[model samples]
Target: MINMGVSFKIPNEYGNHLSDILEPLPFNYYQWLINNDEIHIVHDNEFTNQFLFDEDKIISGEKLYEKSKNNTYYMVFVTLRAFLKDGTIKSVSKYKEFTESDCQIILAVYDCSYVIFWCKNSQLVSKMYMYALSKGYEDIKYITEEELIKNKYYIE
Candidate 1:
């Protein structure tokens, strides 16, 4: 397994505020999203996986649009379906077209497949739970700090 040794610093205000509104999720990616400003949102697209990694880090969707050259606007919420494996640590996907300029690389490890959403707006993180529920996603909850410290290998 590759150890990236990345540590995330989630602002106390952001974490505390998000927890109150959004259901606590157990997925590591969700925890990472709460802490980090930019991420690669990946999902299946027919025969291959499609990835959308932010070109630049921004605090909100408005900032993202202002900074983007294309002015592309992403929805406030999105879903990702990925196949994760233990001992497999890859910062960039072989099949996906991502580079250092595209996003801040993150590391993850898991023993089973999981589905989660990645968002940019901290305030809208909780709203995703309702969207997921409407879309039929089951058992959506937030991951506690204790659980994150115990199970997650990537500290940031």
Candidate 2:
């Protein structure tokens, strides 16, 4: 069974250099994902007005892991699908940048601070919450499907 994921206000303090949660979380908090999942960059600020926004790009986990780990940059949203033990990647929507869909993982950030993550896998959310708590970001909050629809973080 799946549960509604969680949200938190990522600390945006001076000297924090919080470029985006994707950066810190990818390396420090959720590194395991790189090896286990195929990453899809749903949308990004740097890719504004580019095909990356319009087309689905299924990037290999190893490739992304090599490039993004420990780096500080901004990513608007990303969806992840696991590479199963049998070595086949889980299928996902051709495009789910907007309107929630069931993917293995969904990480979305808005205003460079507020984040909402809903994953089919609840353990991932639990670990993410733990990461936030460990970093003194204890404001992780529950979000309703209604709030998600209203927030429209994916919409400009």
Best by TM-score: 2
CA RMSD (A), model 1: 14.6
Which stretches of model 2 miss by more than 4 angstroms?
13-56, 74-102, 144-156
Clashes of 1: 7
Off by over 4 Å in 1: 1-113, 117-122, 153-156
Least well predicted 10-residue stretch by lDDT in candidate 2: 31-40
The candidate 1 region of ten consecutive residues with least summed lDDT is: 8-17
Q: What local lDDT score does residue 105 receive in model 2, on the 0 to 100 scale?
A: 52
Local distance difference test, each candidate? 0.29, 0.44
Clashes of 2: 0
Error of 2 at 75 (Å): 4.7
What does candidate 2's lDDT look like per residue over 18-116, in tens digits? Answer: 223444333332212222222222243232233222333445444445444433344434344433233334343322432343234555545545666
| Top candidate when judged by lDDT against the true structure | 2
Give all TM-scores, in the order shown.
0.27, 0.48
